[model samples]
Target: MVRCVVQSQWLIYSKHLPSISTAKRHSIQAFPLFAISGRGSSSHTLSADDNAKPLLMGPLDNVMPRHHITPKALFIPASSSSKEKILKILKSGLAQTIKAIPTVAGHVKAASNPIQEGSMCVTTPFGAVEDIFTAQDLTESHPEMDYDDLKRRHFPMEAVDSNVVYSLPDLMKAEKPVFLAQANFIRGGLVLGISLHHSFGDGTSLKTILQTWATCCRGESAAPTLTESTRRERLMSSETGASLDEFPEYATIPDNIAGYQPGVAKGEGPEIAPEPPQVDSHVFYLSAQRLKGLKDLASAKLEGSDWISTSDALSALLWRSITVARNLEPGDAATEDTRVLNIPLDGRRIMREDTNSYMGNMILFNNATTPLRNLLSSPPQLPEIARTIRQSISRIDEKYIKRAISAIGSVPDVSKVIMSGGTFGESALTISSWGNLHMDWGHVIGGPSERVRVSKIPFPGVCVILPASEPGNRSTEPNGVEVMIGLKSDDMARLMNDPFFASFAEWRCS
Candidate 1:
């Protein structure tokens, strides 16, 4: 067993087990993690010949955000072992996993094609293990908090700050790491935070990485073997170039918009509000029974032949509740205003190919719009609203996906294009469903995680649906669903107090 002593807001590991040197500890706290490299063996270095070549960027990859992805925090329950032992296991597993997916250990560089000037390419370098992972001793700082309390509350904002759970290079730097992970040793458990560059991959890709890492940590053989071609493939248009006239998703907007930057390429950075609004995040849980009732209510007015999925019903409920919470006055102006719901549609299914092992962004938005009056009526037209969302998403077929790919490829400078449907704010909501992700890490951590949270929501009017704690761990009905939503402070307050909303979703935290 390993012993730990707390002194001066730092953890001092016993001599029997390897301990981080004083210099190394201070360096971890003072400097950016990515800046500390080359401490590992020379074998970690990439060959000059291999390093000279760059991987091609997919059409979807070219239009993704270039900055760091919103970090994901996993709240593991307390275990019997010491924090040092857990950290060692996590780090070792991560090192092994990176060996299989080397692209994630690489850096994002500028694409060579002049026409695709704003796009990105990736290249691996030496000492990737040392540069991408770090551990911080937080037991001394948060001595009073325990696993149960932390699991029930919202993740502390300070824990998500730079150099704490993760770090990033200067925006203007020529290259940046595609993946980063940090382990925070708290009082009773650990918070393992992981971040991936938007250009590197999507949520599905991240899911694969997490599962493989868990398998490695469990000392299991037969962890999936992924090669460069198997993990990633360059996405191109069948028609060398296509026009955007048929694709309404990509548009050019004025610089005065909320996310618009003067010289920065469109879709390259997080959406920033000139004067940041007061937004609050809350997690709401809907039990299986409540979800079924909601679906029945939504389908009451639909024709027998018409069908609406459980996701469609849940999204419809959220959209109507949020709209009502806005408390728009009853008038022509309020009725004329529109509420847009944007749902991200994964392309793997539409392509009719087995891309379960494929990694990278393959997503498009399903824009569903409805007038405020319809959503805010005395008796809301829920069935119609749900049908609208369902139909919008159903429109995305293989042909449509290919056309979108071709249209995005036609852009000379991808940074100049923006989503034309609408922006995310008061009048719009963007919801992404991650309920299908396999989040069980108990095999390695000794117990299932009580909660999983995204470090932050990039903008207001955004929400993420997280998976249940156990896979198929249900009784009588499916397990409950957890939704993390970010909205203006006042709107969130009204939403929490709304009786109709409370009838279904139980508010867990701010």
Candidate 2:
């Protein structure tokens, strides 16, 4: 039976934890009336008093993103409004919609309860936005650089505005790159940048938030309602009093990843993205049926289990594709050392399905690969990649999520994670899918209602985000998952049309 815990808001707050440690730290351990098993079945009783410890942390603490790549360019075309009008709209919208810009940790440090400015968008007492823009970047030219190179680096929750301070309430928020100009009135070229935080939601969520602001600008009503649009929940349960015990006060992070290096030198960073013909967005399709077909084909050739998540399945496909494109032996990507495949896991599952709309970011978990030797030494096949990925994913239990929830505090400095993932490198590639583009921004903006649109900014060599135009209702579009992958000019040129990636018909038709 499909077992899901239903929680009350009080339990959520009461269960909020500051840290997660794998070492059983709690001095309490009492088995409840029901037994607990690894699988979700009624036969395996997960009673209220059992020692479940924590398979997952609070909602926000578990969904923090590992590969947060800023796109080389984020083009926001103010097609209808004057530049000045757009700038005013942006500032006012930002102020009204959020208390502050998001950061890697999902925290938005605000002043006292009654904001001194009385505006949701906070400004530093000295007249700067919260961690808005840095002192160095405020100068003219703001250091001309390449967009692709810096795409992988994490930005402080501060704004590109330069007047903000710092701190996280608990989680981060993923915000889209905003366009602001010196002369809000002038029709000169646009300048692009984003407030560093926003790992809490998917790219589509950010786009919807921006479109929500656009609607606010027009004094129009937003569709789906904010309460309905943004849902949230904490994964840990104190239900029936909870069978799992409290977390160990000081649990250590799993260092099981053989060559897992936390921080790496920024060899190159992404600068600016190219201006597009128009701000074109559409829902791409990746069907469940197609996925099933592929899985069947792979299963015939390779003996692997059918119980696998869609993400693990697709990632295996992409990994196989990349290795093929590179023509490296599966072992080749591995040095005499281990090779890592950085996978980003969403945190929506951690939250209660009934909850909605949050101001900060959530915790993100990654299923990193084992050493190169292991991957290379094993049987070679695309499905095998899937199997390995499945194995890796299996290790990302609630304990690891708990550790990640506490990772923000571990930021040695700069309020960033120490992990050095290849988000901006040409070799790094990411794939993501939003189950279904269930909401529509056009409807909110008072336009003809239609499918929604979203993006995953390109950084991790090749970035992909999938959002279904319809949830399980396949008639709208089966396997209609929007995949948005960004590649530097050459990389895109090489792999854009390869068999591994095909633009969704929804995207093409739109």
Candidate 3:
């Protein structure tokens, strides 16, 4: 039997909040159904003011815009100190933090020369891009949503530029660092908004910077080891060796995909990705006990060298449960053989480099598919599902990473390659796991600091599995995983109620 719990309570709004003048104020949109989890007499804001000139960006930073200036927020539950004290620490830390991560303090500019044959080539010479730092205070602008409400809210809907699918051309032309941060105080906690362009850095890069900032807030002496120079040196080095096999033939274009002719006008994209379907975002917690049970189930079904992992079990369960929720089975002609999962696998380990060494976008999308009919009719074949996902990721070995580098080098505009790489829709699910990122370094704010309870990308239509570590067991035994899923309003409504899914995860839906 499955147990399902639902909560639908509306929260009150605070018309005004106290002021923290160190940070610039920016209006933030209000959200529905929120509550204040802790007690705070007043609210305030603080901005990071760094006046350094914008720095020129490398070719590696110009390829994909999918991650351009993203709004990523972390919920910091109220601490023992007053909100003002905490804000002051964050403000002071920002100054030091921005100085350390120079790239985030600059902006991206395009090539000045309009025409050159190899100009579009990533390895070819290009013009310089500018950069700078900016900050905002969103405390007064947005409606006060409870920490739990924020957790259940569809992150993409609340995120800035949630509709963007690929390439932030506007940000590039402006020659500004594809980064911004907004700080807001809720009733019982604080939401630290960190935004960075994909061109500036990847998830790993962001995590390093945030953790370092946290370290600084705690008055510790920790220097950032990752730098933009590291990324440039690795990519331009001949050692990577231009290998053709690295390119996935199916994912690449036969010719110029973005239609870039060196002498011609820059091509225009499809503008903003069509507004995502009206969707509801939900958060599901997988307790350690339930996590082991699912993995055990998968392991019990496997034989010989074939085995299942914790990730595999979770992925399989989500795929099957979603399929069942949609009622897409054998007799359902419209939905048979339509389920597909896109997993973004990190390539640093496969490339034989220190996994923690370089902070840049080093990942590839691996797609796995199983017919809906097969998934629905197969008598509890989760092991098979787990195996398919495992194989998909395992295939992205050293050879694949090298080929990807070669393919990226050949492309004039990499965004084209990224867009054409996979599918995204109701029938499709793209899951990116940051569980291993180890963001537990956020315990640097005050005396006896609390580690970041919830860290999320808040993008719509996609699922991001972030770290959920207990106070002390982070290094050894992680508490569990927090899965943030976005689906169309009707689809999400049904999915959260699906009995099979409810059996494993604890869900809170709005």
Candidate 4:
């Protein structure tokens, strides 16, 4: 039984307010992940790795990974001015987007290990933008926008299941970096959140680059780019690299699963669950002030000695949301003992320096556990629930990812009739990127909507947040963080209707 005492700081805020300013800043966009072969199969394999534990144990061999082309480009124009702009953006790490094939092709070519996994970011020799500016002008005119308030804006709060394509200026023969990010507005101003490929980089690196780019745009001091060796390459290792035969011990699916039916085996790919006929979708933008308020209130609820993060608070709320919805279902599988929260961990920190930053669909690892179960029952133990969240985050490692990848790829991939060249699919629930956005390209440079697909990401059951727009970054009074509780339509309805779930959520921000 976990006991949580509500601190005065967290107890004072209301749940909803008219303006984003009064509420916690939580503007989140949604994206979903879809396997190339979309269908749900029954045979499961849980991952046994420090970072990933959801993938079940199985004979995983001969799996060719998939790669999506970046919709944007990074090209320096041939003109001297354009070249200068490119240099400026690189020096400061912020350049106007120029979506083209040649530049990104060049980056793809630069990869030392282009076959399986590799990534590279470089300035094209030359590229032209609209008559207003050249790539070079962008480089020299200002530094990247490196402000905390600014950089954090360009990342999507939720990394879900769907494909994405960001904008790049359509320069004839000229190009710039094409990312999966878009530009938007904040408090009547422009912002950017480039939630690119999940394989390219981890959240920390992505966020750092966003800030660095903002600083570059603002003409601030430049941030040094990581060395090429460290910047990319090293994500792929031959099956022999780590003896792909070693599977984790705790990699088997349990006897019973929640929110799912029994024994329909397809394999380790996404099951094609029918989306709601009319899913209610909306994008909410958060202001900096509202976010801070939620954080403050959440902090107030904790002991002075305890430290928790906004992400932590939100995770608790969402987890509770799921439980609440499940409890309402008149199902045999709805047992309090069989729930788990799967967290995606970017194992970059755990790898060697050379591979740490290397990009290219490196791999998948998870950190998941049954969160504080006591909270959803009769009288919620809020503090204990918060502590459990704090503790669950403590156990994450890189070997888990490597091992999981090895195991995923190790499966013989048995198909009665094999396709010439294609991988399989598995139905899953994924959670990535919490509270991130991009306003620079969409709003900063100010381009047409066709220039980018603002909400192309489509991952079901995802939890996303607008970083700086949340309560911690902006708020003065007690309040809960403004977060988009994304779930399949059915899941959403159950969540809002249940009291324990909503109460669990309200307490998380405190």
Candidate 5:
């Protein structure tokens, strides 16, 4: 007998159970409700005063898109664990996580006046847990395919449809939950999709939440403490009196640019081109051996005392390879065409105060520009290109970050400020690394996730560095790194065939 419990009500149903009422069974079938036990139960019911108070939003949060964070899919293979048990565990764990970070349960409230321009807050209401979580039984409708089959197919978009993930319209609604999740159970596995509001936090915060939830699911007492000192104002205080001139990453754009919309935030979605190109997505895996060789080759070119990181070498390779694939004429290199690499730098450790655990946006974009001739030189300048990239990263110190924040605060309207380093387009590339995040869910599901994937890429000329499947194993180094890239169809074809690129990056998809 399968006993499903919701709050104080118990609804029991199974293939062999015939004594249950038709109406009660129908209700269970319509909505498969699960109860959240532990601390979540006590805080599930909010008081009138709790609902009236609004959570604070930092300055960085305001500039972020008002939509949901990019959705991520975690694939768990089939096991003896029943669907009810998994949902119950996840629900309880999520509820406890929300109890620690209450801001996630709240909804964003847009600013109505100039004073509140970059200080929008989230308002929490009662009974929001139900709206934040959902479960769907897709065993009959969609059976799980082989893991290798799914990977070769690049994980179809339909796998993360509205049935298992929140739609953009639903997320844009002001009343929707700041954090949303759905669990789809198929014939042979489970697909878990989770999304948080961009205004609520960044990738680090999401990692903390997931880690804490997993701990709780394992029947342990684990709850993160979000203190007042960790708020955005602490790091981006306008009282510092820093000047915007010191920050060179951002510039003012004229209002006459076509398709430029006023008051709309950056990263709201993918930028729409006048004539959009045909884009294709692919994943490339670089084994540890290849990465070491690439790093050694690039390091040999560096002068004494000058060094580059693994990330730098990899980025340099991609930059050079991508430029070659663009198919620019050799004579065109004489022109002043330059390729730009936009890298997001995390400001947690650079700050004087310890904000490593702060669950808000602390990321700033740093652009590295290279002339077409230098990148297309006869012999590859991997080391020189890497040094340039390293220099751009090293320039971002605590002082520079603070000044950047102050510059942002001084603007009359943040929506008008544009990042000088282009976000999307063929000439620019944005590479974001999430390889250091903790996403192991073996404790809850009885095994590690087979694969983790971004549901969709928002634009072309973008690449994401995903974390290793077994990141927690300290005994041995990571097997390799997986890079997901989206580029023009023709450019992708050229990249795949390029001997230099094929030598390092192994294509993982069909």
Candidate 6:
């Protein structure tokens, strides 16, 4: 099934631009140029040949608005000497990367058959570049804030101005640029902002492209392994199994034959109450200590069940905490049943396919539900809540993923019809984890002198969980997981006031 995944990144930080006592003065220059799509791959370059043409949107991409964009960012501290060279590499290699991942170089267009398949086509894709600002200007622009505060200010919580960078000309505005980038020189550091349409791909796809770009920037000759061989046709062909009725709508089931029932169905469920009009974004982190306590709490109640992951426990905790913040009553069965945790699981490594090099959206949601009363019980049943999430995730095995892929492929407008459920209703939460995405790997610029120290990204209305380095495992410690959430003003106020919720994270509100 075609999945239209949107992603973006906006990072604000200066490499080696700390206190004068710690940072040396460095000169900065800018190279802002749009990188056109290339046509071949070789040492120091990537080119598209077969899949280079305008590609049709997949079932996944059909769900969201064709014009919608997702923004994200990265912070890299580099030396003054290597900064120019780095930008040169990026400018030169951008074409190569696009050639390898043609979708990123393409833009959306009106599809001939909108009803049978998706309505947009990603055509003539290209990358746009812009110099945002220098480190001194970035610091001067917001002098009231501290270093950390400045980083938060530059985080891309929403869509950026595509026109300022790699936007298509009015005459050629057939579709959104599959990708747009902006480079901000932070004294001796650099911040890169990239925005992608939701229909293009998911986090995995974006990361894959970036990693490949990094490889090319470092002068690697290896071309990205595009596994579009026979799989492309399988995901696009009309199939009966992709029917919304046959598959569990709003939520997914472990097996098609099991017939497990969820609380809601596609286009047949009650609408969730409207969300509060005003909303704000906040970022919080779960330290190793608090995370350990949470895992222990969840495990305490497992009673010899299969192991639960840190992700499961945290999701349950957040679900429980949000329910409490909403002041949900402990005894309302109807209110309780609607509360759900929409956790998306990646299907790349699993299914035993060497699809690690594969791009586009490859994800399935595990919608776990529990009543408010059970979650907010006298002592709070953390384990049971965690178990529910674990079970839901467990159901996403080879059989389930294969079925989901087929199911997504079956529907022409899969996003609109299948899983048409709303998160606004019933206090539902959707969480995306970047802990395993390896975003920090090869995220260096110029030389190895300075690396990407931190990244600030939040899913405006949803939740994003990122990982830090593990304990004793210093290698991954820098990549520790942090949760970024955007909530209504009222919800944010309550969430911050709740000591229990506040204790687990440092609430950095924006």
CA lDDT for candidate 4: 0.32
Q: TM-scores across all candidates?
A: 0.82, 0.46, 0.71, 0.48, 0.81, 0.72
Model 6: per-residue Cα lDDT at residue 233: 31
lDDT of 2 by residue, 101-172 (tens): 222112222113321111011112212233232111212353332222222221111112222111112123
Off by over 4 Å in 6: 1-52, 113-115, 124-174, 227-231, 234-242, 250-276, 328-337, 412-415, 422-426, 435-461, 469-479
Candidate 1, residues 1-510, lDDT tens digits: the string is: 112211100111111222222222110011111110111211132235554567656767766656555667776666787777777777787788776666767877666553454667786453456788888877888675456566546444334444565555556666777877777777777777777776767777777777767777777532443543223333433543345556545553333544345665433344432443667877788887898999999998787789999889999999899888876464544546777877877777676544445567777756788877888876777898999999998999877776676666666566544444343234656777763434455444655555666545534667777657423546655777888788888888888998988999997665
Models ranked on lDDT:
1, 5, 6, 3, 2, 4
Candidate with better lDDT, 3 vs 5: 5
lDDT per residue, candidate 3, 1-510, as tens digits? 000000000000011112212122111111111111111211111113222223322323433443243445555665667666766776666666655654445544443442211212111121121222223334455444554455445332233222221122353243434455555565555655555556555666666777766777777755645333223434322224443233332232233324334444232222233233455666677878888998988677576888767988898888776666556344664554456676766655566544454545555556687766656754557777888888877888765655455445544433323222222234656666652433332343333323222332232345656556334566676587767676666666777887767878886332
Worst 10 residues of 2 by lDDT: 4-13
Compute the lDDT of residue 247 as modeled in candidate 4.
25
- lDDT minimum window of 10 residues, candidate 5: 5-14
Q: After TM-score superposition, what is the CA distance of residue 244 in candidate 2 from its true location, in Å?
A: 23
What's the alpha carbon RMSD for model 2? 14.1
Clashes of 5: 0
**Evaluation by lDDT, superior candidate among 2 and 4:** 2
lDDT for 481 (candidate 3): 71
For candidate 3, the clash count comes to: 17
Compared with the true structure, model 2 gives a TM-score of 0.46
Off by over 4 Å in 3: 1-63, 66-69, 80-87, 112-173, 227-230, 236-270, 327-329, 333-338, 412-415, 421-426, 435-461, 469-478
Tens digits of per-residue lDDT for model 6, 360-438: 5555656676776777776778888888888877877766665555555454333233242232342546666762433
Better structure of 2 and 3 per lDDT: 3
Instruction: Report, for every candidate in turn, its global Cα lDDT versus the true structure.
Output: 0.63, 0.33, 0.48, 0.32, 0.61, 0.50
Question: In model 3, what is the error at residue 102, expressed in angstroms?
Answer: 1.3
Clash list (residue pairs), candidate 5: none
Looking at candidate 1, the ten consecutive residues that score lowest on lDDT are 27-36
lDDT of 3: 0.48
